[model samples]
Target chain A: SQTIHQWPATLVQPVGSPLSLECTVEGTSNPNLYWYRQAAGRGLQLLFYSVGIGQISSEVPQNLSASRPQDRQFILSSKKLLLSDSGFYLCAWSVKRGQPQHFGDGTRLSIL
Target chain B: AQSVTQLDSHISVSEGTPVLLRCNYSSSYSPSLFWYVQHPNKGLQLLLKYTSAATLVKGINGFEAEFKKSETSFHLTKPSAHMSDAAEYFCVVSPIYNDMRFGAGTRLTVKP
Candidate 1:
């Protein structure tokens, strides 16, 4: 069985502070990784996706960026956070392009 | 390009009643579709996916969806609604599996 893990589960960050959310997948190799933001009306916005290590694609231009440091380890980071950056951030992994994605518990980030 | 649309922003249903969440998609060619559920402040869970095999796909928790090519729709339905079924549901479309587009999401509320 494949499992995706994300942390810190919940986060409270001050404005202009740095942000880093980690997501790792187990029981799979060379999986596609994705980062999404869930907002009230905007729905689930795809922020970034990676096909392999050191490869990331930005779906929406925003204050966030993503990185695939390892085969199964993805990281979402920001040098400086903004108030608009507050939302539920979810990480997902899929075996390939046509497969259903498995998601992690997500990190609820609140910008103070 | 591909996109998804969830018909209802919110729906209220009584327990044990039939549940239907409408979803429609647009794409240039054959695309993959998926239905996902998310609890409050939680990550999205894959309920089912349509990858061109079967028209009717069954998923976990007694949930299922039918893919209608003539209608360009992939609507999710449950025989009986449960209290646990109350959550946010998303319809996703992928032209190449890696290109994911999410809907605005339909929030299902099951009343006692």
Candidate 2:
């Protein structure tokens, strides 16, 4: 069974602070990883996705960026956070393209 | 390109009543569709997925959805609503590998 892990379960950050959220998958190899953000009263917006190590595609232009350092390790980071960056961030993994994605327990980020 | 639309932003249903959450999608090619549920401040969980095999797909927790290519719809339903079913639901569409789109989620409220 594949499992995705994300942390910290919740985060509170000040404006202009740095942000880094990590995601890793177990029991799978070369999986596709994705980063998504869900705002209040809105659906999820894909921020980034990675096919392989050091390869990332940005779905929407935003202050956040993603990286894949290992085959199953993905990281979402920002140099400086904005108030608009506050949201529930999710990490997902899929065995292949166009397949069902498995999600991790999201990180609720609040910016003050 | 692929896009998804969830018919209603919010739906309220009484316990023991049938549940219907409508979803429609568009794609250049045969698309893959999925439904996911999100509890308050939690990550999205896969409810069901349509991959061109079965028209009617059964998922976890007594949830099911029928894929209608003629209507470009994949509507989710349950015979009886449970309070635990109250959550945000998302409709997703994918035309190709790594190109997934999400609908503005539908919030399901099951009343006792």
Best by TM-score: 2
The CA lDDT of each predicted structure is 0.91, 0.91
lDDT by residue (tens digit), candidate 2, A57-101: 998998898999899999999999999999999999987778888
Q: Mind giving the per-residue lDDT tens digits that candidate 1 earns over A2-110?
A: 8999999999999999999999999989999999888755588788989999999898898788888899999999999999999999999888876788889999999
lDDT (tens digit, per residue) of candidate 2 on B1-112: 6789899999999999999999989887788899999999888899988888999999999999999989988999999999999999999997766556889989999998
TM-score, candidate number 2: 0.96
The 10 consecutive residues of candidate 1 chain B with the worst lDDT sum are B93-102
Question: What is the clash count for each candidate, in the order shown?
Answer: 1, 0
**Model 1 pairs in collision:** A97-B97
Task: Tell how far residue A19 is off in model 2, in angstroms.
Answer: 1.0
